[model samples]
Target: MRYLLPLLFLVALFAMLMLRGYVHNEILADHRIRPDASTDTVPERILDGGPVIDARGTGKPTSLDIPKHKLVLTFDDGPDPTWTPKVLDQLKKYHAHGVFFVTGANAARYPDLIKRMVDEGHEVGLHTFNHPDLSYQSHARIDWELAQNQLALEGAAGIRTSLFRPPYSSFADAIDDKNWPVIKYVGSRGYITALDSTDSEDWQRPGIKTIVKNATPKHGKGAIVLMHDSGGDRSQTVAALDTFLPELQGKGYTFVNLTEALNAPSAHTPVTGMDLWKGKAFVFAVQVSEHTTDVLVGGLAVIGVLVFARFGLMLILSFLHARKVRARGFRWGPEVIEPVSVIVPAYNERECIANTVRSLMASDHPIEVLVVDDGSTDGTADIVEAMWLPNVRVIRQPNGGKPSALNNGIRHARYDIVVMMDGDTVFEPSTVRELVQPFGDPKVGAVAGNAKVGNRDSLIGAWQHIEYVMGFNLDRRMYDVLGCMPTIPGAVGAFRRTALERVGGISEDTLAEDTDVTMAMHRDGWRVVYAENARAWTEAPESVQQLWSQRYRWSYGTMQAIWKHRRAVFERGPSGRFGRVGLPLVSLFMVLAPLLAPLIDVFLLYGLVFGPTQKTVVAWLGVLVIQLVCAAYAFRLDRERLTHLVSLPLQQVLYRQLMYVVLLQSWITALTGGRLRWQKLRRTGAVEAPGGIPTQRGSKENIDRRPVA
Candidate 1:
């Protein structure tokens, strides 16, 4: 069910996107009208035939000329909202009937006009959807055009049209090798090709008098006069029609529909049953897609604004934060010289426990190391115990979760200031000193340290390394300036024992214990800040599966913590301040932003495949450039090498999608009231404490150093 829901949502989203592309004339748009070139395949009879040609007959194609003094007036490229109504009004004023050839795109958009034509005793015909030149189209394309046109007519007026006119068509004598085959194929599909006998050239917007003169038949002969009610300013056509209808009538000429002039039955057949319903369904889907696209576009605009606003805020405030921290006189009170107790929570972490413990013993600050073994089956506790190092204690417990183990460690600790880190993490020699320095301020409750990916040489690790530097650490700096730092890294962080007791230790209600406790400290009116110099290197997941599991838990847990503290928004004092500022920031940047971020890529694909490729590429690259600028600044602030950033673009393409899917699944699980358990990742112990202990994997000397209990 988890997998199926996201798949269904994506499929529906894609379907709506395609429908919007089609309706907006982006997909399969007609760009150029082919010019007359060859006539090698044309028969002389068709070239000299009358306006109404019936090539459906088995023998030579037959043509019918209108009887004397009878005129067939036809309009093309219509059902236009502006000009179509005026044409229909003029037709009604004269009590004249004409054939309106409507394109499927316009007809589907303005069905009322098509219905009005049918109700006013006028004829409707197909002019091909999108007004594409059929001479250059394939047979399948020709059939699709006819079928889609018929579908629109059926949906609009419950009738099917057999009268067809190819776009850019002219008098029958102009038929050439290129278009003759198209006319025949259309004929084979049961349509009567209605060519123009006299061209009014109204689309060119000639003078009304010229249009009227051009439309009049020579020598009192019957003819199919072609004009337009759409495709341009048609006031001349309307004015010409007004003058020509009565002027021709004064000359004893009658303006009749195409079928009447041809002496044939009505070309429109009433549709019923499933066909009618299907046509209505298609129209409904298009309407819904258009409206949905409108809403999505508006949302895209809003997200675009929010994204830029966030970047602007980060860039400005990060600069301020750097200046504030780097100032010559800046200090977090006097240097914190008190001894500290560091807690290491281990659960099946046999690969990295030795490095983790030795890193703490190597810290510049005076400290005691407590390795809380949470029921590891891989002899994780035995390895630590076998080391028999002084000032390091190995505590055994049942297989409780991380929060439970941390709470146990806190209860057993003897120092007022306590530091916590993951068993797979290795801290620098000065990390503990730097992390605890913030506690010199009496109000400081917790300090968040910078977490670096130690296994960053792998592709997945490189992507995560970029995210930690660009996304996570950069956000921490901005949040620090705002006084709403949300999450402290579980890999390395420091807290006051009094503050921990006041906030009831770590709560087991959320998977993100670090974030939950951090928020708790804020609500308790204690300050939580970021320490950029307190860096801890942890092994990042190397494979996609492990990354997915880790991020899924983190995403879901962050949401849980946010929801759990939602009431703080309405509370008074520090709680209210943090809630109003912290929660909204977290929700916007962490939750809503990532959820809607995919829209940029989605539209990029849409534009690349459908149209406007250059603009699309420029827009997408512009956004990428913005991200690159931000990332480069972040890397410079962290003082890290920038070569790993070469994978940043591919990370946006592939890695971000995996993160989006994981976050989406987390949302689904959260909303559905489904619970998730902690997922332990396999560690390779890639990180090591400098100049302390050689914890390399399968080192014979290190193994031999382990004394028997």
Candidate 2:
């Protein structure tokens, strides 16, 4: 339900955009108006067919019935900067005036234009705000549109326009049964509705000659000529006026404003304080929305660029790391042969604790396994003690959490090198040896082991396996190359005891204690490296609920860790490298990328409905192809079965949304100052006992190793 609110809010925002014409209007047919048409184009004769508007009403008289050679020019949808000035100049050249019917939005934008219309002996009239077909709108909406337009006009030019024009209506003849009610309402409001007698269709961008011909009356008598100075490229309208105005003057036809042509006094009212404030508020809202839109679009563009840049860099660097690994092979420290202490922090992980211990006991390196039980009521400690392995020991602790338990384990460690493994995970026989080998470099303080998803026979597990192989592992290789490995998975990692002591052991400050500890190591000037061959199989959640809970902890804990070390970005040397390089990469790829990824689906659906179907399909397929190639490469490098690639599309459809939601929840929790507890997953114990199967693709001598599942 928490996720539902944000998703719905986003959908509603897009709907608002659609209504405002930012998104497609096909879904709301009434909001979609033809560019060149408004209610004002409706014939007046149709209104006369009913008792909609009395021809002898108090409304100002129209100029449809006029003397010979008298012309009335009316331009709708004006205050446009580009063509309005040109139109005004042409009219001024011939000493002519025309009625400018302006939409409220445009009127507010160019108040000087409205003032110029009145200043130069031209008439100003209301054309509503946003130019909707008032006949199709509700009564309240119609009222709001008219009232808002009146306020805008009064504020812009200190005049309330009584001469009104309903959008989509043209000549008095265009007023029809469909628009008669709206016309009647405006007439009731004491607004004289002006309609055209002739329309030039100048908005279609027809040649100037055609526009001139269309505007010229056949009998050279009285006519209100309809044209537009906005809503499109009105160059033809301006050009036609340049040539036609002089031609009309040569023919002894005098051009006049609507009021003079009709021989009626101006019905415009004075501006009021209330109208000014309302107009100001509306203008302020428009400005804020516009600026907000600019910022949002700019931010999205930045995020998109960062995401793709990280992908490109990681792909190249990961490829190089793989090549180097293949060519030179892994090297171990001679000192790594010393005995190591392995810590298993258990908390109600009884189902997989035995397997975890057995796997560690089978390690090729001399090691002692310390199982620090963090107040488990499920006999998790009993299970470990039942193993009775000589090198394995169990310790009890209060319910303090994983960090406290790990700290307890470190205190009991009797070796220089310490290995940490979750009680729910199993490792290969040589995993411990492989994990600590990177410490061969004295400066190397920590090793991040390759953690894989066990129990992958299920579809959910399969998706997780793919993520582990393609996303996390590939990222680790990239981080390793950049000398800024940010996390050492608690499922399997090795640390020098001295290095751990120097950083004050694991702190409970973050839920991701491993990440917190590793970052501290980096800031303390110790190099953190990745051990690709040190593979550990950990059980993944079998259900969506469990997955959500587990990820929420991981993500929230990671955020806490990042926040705690955020200042390292400005520090010197290694700390600065981790902060600048590692932190940003983690933030971009892990956090921001996932948050923005949902937009791809949103836009995909939008394109499916309102965009060119072929182009949308091609674009969507192009993205999928890139993902497929990346996944394939990651699988090849990790030596995993390529068959799992089949789930990639389905995972995108289902699993991706869940992960996005998890990240969002984590961020929300972090921002709201809400705390999240360590939520343990129910271990299914799907991993088998150590058997004679070599690591996925290694030697047969150490044949008793298997993949996570």
Score each candidate by Cα lDDT.
0.88, 0.78
Q: Among all windows of ten consecutive residues in candidate 2, which has the lowest summed lDDT?
A: 700-709
lDDT of 1 by residue, 1-709 (tens): 7578777877898999898788667888877878778888888777877888887857667777888899889999887889999999998998889999998888887888889999999999999877888988999888888898888888888999889998888988899888888888888888899999999988888799999989999999998999999888888898888899999999999888888877789998999999999888887777778777877777778679878988998899899999998999899998999889999999999999988888876788998888888989999999887776656777788999999889998988889999999999999999999999888789899999999999898889999999999899999999999999999889999999999999999999999999999999999999999999999999999898899889999999999999999999999999999999999999999988887787788888888989689998999899899999999999999999999999999998888778878888988999899999999999998887765853344444443224222
List runs of model 1 lying over 4 Å from the truth.
Answer: 15-32, 38-50, 59-75, 78-98, 105-122, 155-157, 197-202, 205-257, 260-264, 288-292, 693-709
RMSD of each: 4.7, 7.1
- Candidate 1 global CA lDDT score: 0.88
TM-scores across all candidates? 0.87, 0.78
Which window of 10 residues has the lowest lDDT sum in candidate 1?
A: 700-709
